[model samples]
Target: MTWGKVREIRDGRCGKGRAGDGKESGGGRRGRGVETGQSLTLQSLTQWKVPDLGSGEGSQEGERVKSGGICAERAIAKHRAQRTPISSKNSSDCPRTPRHSLNMGIFRFRLMLLCLIGSLSHLNSSVADEAEDISHKDADEAEDISHKDVHCGVPVNISHGHYEYLSHHDDDTYLSVIKYACDGPVYHLEDPEEAVYICTEHNKWKNAKLKYKLPECHKVSCGVPKDIEHGHFEYVTTHGVTSYLSAIKYTCDANYHERDFSDEGVYVCTIEGKWRNTDLDFEIPTCEPVLCGRPVVHLETHQRVVGGQMVVNGASPWSMLLRGADGEIIDGALIAHQWMLTSAHALQGEGRSEAEIKANFHAYVGIEDAREMDSAHEVHIDKIFTHPKTKDAMVYSNDLALVKLKENITYSNHIMPICLPAHDLAAPGKVGHLAGWGMGVELKPATHLLYVELGMANASQCLHQLAQKQPGLFTEDAPDLFCTQRSALEENVCRGDRGAPFVVEEGGVEYAAGILSYDEACRAYTYAVYTNIYNHLDWLKEIMANH
Candidate 1:
């Protein structure tokens, strides 16, 4: 018997023992009735063959094999071995129930087989229904996953950088968002508020820019520098790029300088994207107009005398040296961009004519030692204006003159003009400096320049002192020149010192108080006659205005 049939018997679907499945069969025979050649089904079972175990023919079949289903396979094997006609090739020819087996009744056996087949068919139907339901469930889950993938587009990408999601999400739904960022120093968000984007209607992202344009990742930058009032700036590193790590240097224009001494005017890009000077913490440096009369140097504070110690470089920036066509050098003072003050007699020195003086008249400055004049920037003289009341070269009254230069000067620390005095009267007892050209009185000219300090004397003292030399030149009431006397009664202010500026410092600014006009040939001691500079302010202003 097949395992299926055996299971049916084990389920108690055999003989008269079953009630709900079908009617009784072989009421007391203690055996199952089944059809050997018919396929089982729930609706049909009339072709069963029942054996007569009461007769010797049935007894010889399986009494020794045991009738209980506990040895069902062994009993079936022995019973099939006992088939008649030596078990013919066709199962129908194997055996047949004799007419005596009709005692068990064909109706009863058919009832048993029908009930067993019906139970088996119901079990198979339930399993197929459950399997179909599972298949449909799996297909729905797969469709949900595929639909999510097709709901939205790709992620956003920015120039110079990438991005990431602000928060995890199951799908790119309407309201999903991403936050944008950039590599430090090298790149940054142009608008940080726009760094985040939200998925809006139509499955598109939106930010402060409104459109779905990827937020820009621009190179970090400090914009073009602030414009200085009298200066400008230039790049020190890669040109045309104001991005991260850029460098720049600021410079003042001609005749201008940075007001703050601490600021070096060199700047660099910072990590936070600001331009800053390495040594200073202030904002952009400013360029102010050069303050006149202030020397761009530090000097020794000791007192100076007549023909005293040598002056430091940059200490007397306004002091000038003039050379004529005859190669004669004298001292002069730069008082403005194109105007200089000097002694009128120095203009006509060496007996040269006015035309000869203007032919190759050049001014040299910025050097104390003449040998170091590697760049002798020769500024040509455009014109000369001698005082209207000035006498001959041998006279001392009205001895001051003005020289106009052909080109305008761009002032610097080494070549700046001195400030003019505010009042026109020579202040009595005020001390002043007189720079000396080392053309020694009886000796050859020296390369280095020297300076001396002198005190202005009262008009009576000045006039009394001058009367001893040029006796008839002036009186106390209306002296033609003022006197400056050295405290130390040492060497005299002589010929080579002609045209030197008597510079006085007031309120930290140097001003031309007088011009050397009548320093005798080393004969007069401790005192020199200078053409009054303050008294000639009106004439100086008028000449400069007309020019």
Candidate 2:
């Protein structure tokens, strides 16, 4: 039977009872000899027969039906041959009816339809799953782009002094430049101070090791020491640069001598950038006058040679002439073998340079006459330890200064050091002796060393006189100062006698009690101000010990 006819017959038969009868309801057709409710097999479907159309039962329509039924039977037989037969206890029990055959054919067609529907559903589900995977992949790509935008190609911040930044082409690598500050020119094991720094991908600047091989930039300097007045210094390492790890040494000029101190006179730059002593116990080096031993004494009378009447030669062996490039500037006392006591004003040149100051002054020791320097010892000034307060005020309030000689003065008969007083022993009415190569009664320079006897003046009397003479200059008598007045006419120290010592005899030994600081122009009744040396004894001892 044709496929369309078989479908139409199967539908018509299914509308009837579910029995396996081959009976046609219309025209009262006779039932086929097949039992109702019987199971059909592949053999039954194949053996089903089509009625002959030439028997004239239904004429032309019957012929058409018979032809379709014949084709349907042939198709069923072919399908049966390809399918496995169902095994049963009685194979012959299966019916050979066309109705059963039609029902079997319809059952096979429905199974195939269900299978096709399932396959189509599975294919659609697979397409949807593939689309979801693609969407997730796109999202991941976008996330990666966002991450790259955040971290890459961003600038770093660096704000240290003398430091600069340099960038590299590779994003993971960077470089920075460092500049020299106060501590460097040479850094890191004698390496030329390079300010360059490198940063790797893993080695960030936060983890970088910065080694400060040199001293810190701030605290590094060997400034001019007040004690080193007459000598010159130079850096042994780098000139004009006093950075860390540098060295400097000092030397005295011709005829000048350095004190025999423990220090080797060399200073090394420390990590703090300051010049420090190798031993750490001392400070800068010191120089002093060369010693010459005791002077000659008269054997018979136990007295030295006398000349110039009261101004006798060698009467005041501790007296010294402080000479400048021009002439005698002031007088000083040899208080110690290496130290000289002077007035602060004697060294004052407020606007002068260091070179000018050094070129101007020198110490002339053991001289009976200022003009005769042949037999005298010329000692160069090493360092001048001036009072810090005096230097600030630019005045003579604390007008005492100690001069360190280039070499220690040898104890000579004419160049012996005088003793300092034990206390502020200035008593009013006590007589003190002052000597210097100053203007005499005639206001002219003396031919020889001049001497005078002056009486110590009380504070009240001295203050009254000073206030009357120069108002606002000597407002009050400072504790470190004392005044002296000539006991007789023509016995007065004049303008050139500044820095001379006022000596008092105690136990037959002269002790320096004051430093001659200032005096009015020589007058009939003259009084002079002197810095009380006793008050500054502690400062003197301390400076002497360290320097």
Off by over 4 Å in 2: 1-310, 349-355, 391-394
Can you write out model 1's per-residue Cα lDDT over 264-332, one digit (the tens) per residue? Answer: 478888766788886565388766777778875533445544345577746787878886556567888
lDDT of 2: 0.60
Can you give the lDDT of residue 175 in candidate 1? 65
TM-scores of all predicted structures = 0.49, 0.43
RMSD of each: 20.8, 26.6
Q: Evaluate model 1: give its lDDT.
A: 0.68
In order, the Cα lDDT scores of the candidates are 0.68, 0.60
- The candidate that achieves the highest lDDT relative to the unseen native structure: 1
Give the least accurate 10-residue stretch of model 2, judged by summed lDDT.
298-307
Deviation from native of the Cα of residue 288 in model 1, angstroms: 2.3
In candidate 1, which residue pairs get closer than 3 Å at backbone N, Cα or C atoms, i.e. clash? none
